[model samples]
Target: MADKSNKFDEKLPFEAAIDKAGYGLYSYIMTALAGVAIISFVCIVFASTIIVPTSACELGTTGSQQGLLAAGPVVGSLLGGILWGYQADNRGRRKMLLVSLCGGTIFNLVASISVNWIMLMIFQFIAALFASGLYSMSMSLLSESVPMAKRNLVVLLVSSIFLLSQGIMAALAIPIIPLPFSFHLPALGIYWNSWRTLLVVYSSPSIITIIWLYFMQESPKFMLVKGHEEEALKILRVIHRINHFRSKEEFEVLGLQQEAGQEAALTSSVKEQVAPLFKMPLLKYTIIMTALFVINQVGAFLVWLPTIADQFVRIMQTGENSDLNMCQIINTESPVDDSVTPCSLNETSLLIVLGVGAMQSIFNFIISIVVNQVGRRNIVMMVTALCGVSGILVNLIPSALGSAVVFGVLTLGVVVVGLYTAITVSLFPTQLRALAIALAMTGGRIGSFASIQILNLMLVNSCDAGFYLFSSLFAASAIVASFLPDDRRGKVAALAKEETHKNELAIKTGND
Candidate 1:
């Protein structure tokens, strides 16, 4: 058998040729796909802040009922992720993406006009089912398309851009859609309720993204594996044309001829592809990664702003010892009312959260540059440890200094989030990539659900215990990080191939 590390062993000639066209076109396409994925994050992160509160007010929902409404999308995402992963791996990433985006746009548009909580929940779930596909497919497609040397950086960049989109949505949710059209839409029969209007605006990106994706080609590697040599060649030709500004006719002729020869020489059995993923070596690595991801999700859920806001408020009050009240903070008024008294944080907390989000985006961008150089394991370890430290400080700080401490802790949390995003994208093989991401993200969703429940039960009663619980989860994540293999800078395909060979040998010896 050929050494799996050799690029020739894994990629067909035509597949390699696509990468030769230049990184610019490839990077652009990845960024576009990544942007689509960000819509899901934006919706999920801002739901409690911008969507749920508005929904609760407009629908006259009880607090417990509001919690269920908030959980609708995540519940939908958990199921959608698993379904989309199977579809993405078996069908094609491009097809999955088109279907997901188009469906999401329609669902979100409908959600904007929902008459009651039931209708709203149903539409939100439908939207999530489509939106969930964006992240898993994007990671799988980008990981398979790029060169091994540049793969980590590309993945990091994609994740960073996705995070940045969340910040953009946060900024826009308050000032643009909710504020400007809040009253104007009532005359137009639109009833520009905060959450409804936000959904309407959020769906706008999906419309443009779906249209753009329609013109994009499928992954060349996916085409080759599925025996669509001509289709793969046409895609390669287009890429070459885009990168070099060559005549499409000339590139098509060259590409088809090259792909035809390569296809004849390369043959991979289905068993070879499927067997290694479930056997030893690969199985071991999968278990370790899955466990690390599950632990990471726990911390991720705990650190989310909405999940801990009530607890942080209590800490702020204790520190300030002022008559800062939540009752006066109405939807029409600013978050902070200076006329009453100075509290721990009012409108400044919003700014602090935005600043933290911006800092997260910047850190993620830097991680994109340094990920391939420093390697994945070291970065994960360092970031996980820092997150643990921050989580502890968020709870330990005195009430008077709580706001400052919370801001600093949030900054560190953002940095950790960037690192986790980079590492998750780099940890799986192309064939199993979507499944791996879905599984990890599903873990996060589960954590988010549990954290929400904890908040409803515990934080509503004793807020301090909630912070301690969150901090403990962060510490556990650091412990899990220490168990992961140091394969950050390595090629996932090469690693998968090597593990396959070892598992094959072990099976043969056992039979003998």
Candidate 2:
């Protein structure tokens, strides 16, 4: 029966292959991945704002020291991405995700009980490694499992949930800290700080994800390649039973059968599975998409919208009229003069950040709709150009218009970010998709790390220079984005097959 099913799939058209598999399975997998993606985003964004600020305040660390602490994740993420990507290509997505999530949960727990700043940094780096791995693997699995027609929408939807995680972190940070109970080290007799408490709270979510994922099945595509026909058929039957609300007989009628005697034929090794990714056509797309990924990362890093928003608030308070700059605001040396109402740091700035985050999700939804229609290259170029322009405006805008325009520019910048993110997901093939994304994301993290360091340096002198520096990075990203190719909508498998055929014919002709 398994053999018959495999034969049926081999004979079916590309679209038919998608249709034969149960969409319900894809949906379930994507839903799970989306949850993990959100957690990953929350962990990173939360660490940047809540953890860094609290740790720095507690330790009396300098701006540069804070910058290094902030960059710890990116440093770990770069290494983790390459390691996990190679693992996914070899071991499979489901296994890697579970491993990564479990690792992340343990590391975050350790981080929450750190003895010193050094231990805190080390644990954060370990947590980051797992988080980065989880992120890349989830997206790659989603891409491979979904149909061509629905892939863009699914990828965008799954990725967009990461935005909501940021909001969740913000909401959680307020309540978790200043709690009555805190960890105390008997050896040192010092209670664990609020920052440590926050880490403990944040780490709780990963425990749920880790347990839930253990019950999940492997991707049908991965199973097929690995020659696990019986297991693949079982998964397909379950999916079919769920989707059609019927039994195994109904699933068999739908042509979800395994190929005859293909178990012996299915001898393709892991090396064989990955070798095509480096060959022609696939290799070309990989290079192009990787370059775009690097460019987008550089732009994303420089346009740290949250930090810029903070600076905007400071500038608004200090510019010409107010007596205080950021230092005075932080140190509270002089009582804020009644005549000068310091910009309210409550929901207003938070709302602006939320608005920007929402705008990014909205733009992602828009790209999901139009990506197949307008093509990937054009959308990237246009959005990247807008991003560059918005960065410049963000730098140039005087802080006089009371926070409203600051909010608007930041929101616009986020929209551009969404646009670029959508393009990145669409450009790579499933086999190499996760690794490509990891590399790209890691590159972006590097850019972000550099931006943070630069911002810290400039904050010592002038806040304005940081915004200008960010703008320059976006401008450079736009220049790089213009060179990418369009149209990543068709079947990657079919493309690979066609390339293989062409190569065979060329070799035959050369031999003749």
Name model 1 segments beyond 4 Å from true: 1-15, 44-48, 176-191, 246-278, 298-350, 399-427, 488-512
TM-score of candidate 1 versus the correct structure, residues matched by position: 0.78
Question: Candidate 1 lDDT, tens digit per residue, 1-512?
Answer: 34433423234464356556445565567666665666554554335444665455567777677667767777777778867876786689989988888887788788888777788888888788777777778777766666555666766666666656645555555454334234545543545545566778787777777777777778876676567767776776566666656434234223322322223213433344444445665566556565665555333332334323433344454444333222111111233434532222233334445555666667777766776656576777766667656655654553434534553553454444445544555544444557656766776667666666665555456655655666556656666777655554455457545543464453333233
lDDT of each: 0.58, 0.57
Q: Which has the greatest TM-score?
A: 2
Backbone clashes (count) for model 2: 11
Per-residue lDDT tens digits for candidate 2, residues 1-512, read 78877644444432345455556754666666556655754574346555665555455667666677777766677678777887785678888887887787788777877666677778888888877777667766666565656666776676566655555665565554434355668985556766677787787677767776677667665565456656656666555566556435354333233332223324435455445445554566455555545544332332334454444454455554244433223223322544422322233444546655566666667776877767656666666566555544543443445233432443444333444444555554334456656666666666666666666666456655554555555556556666655455564345445544443333233223
Which candidate wins on lDDT? 1
Query: How much lDDT does candidate 2 score?
Result: 0.57
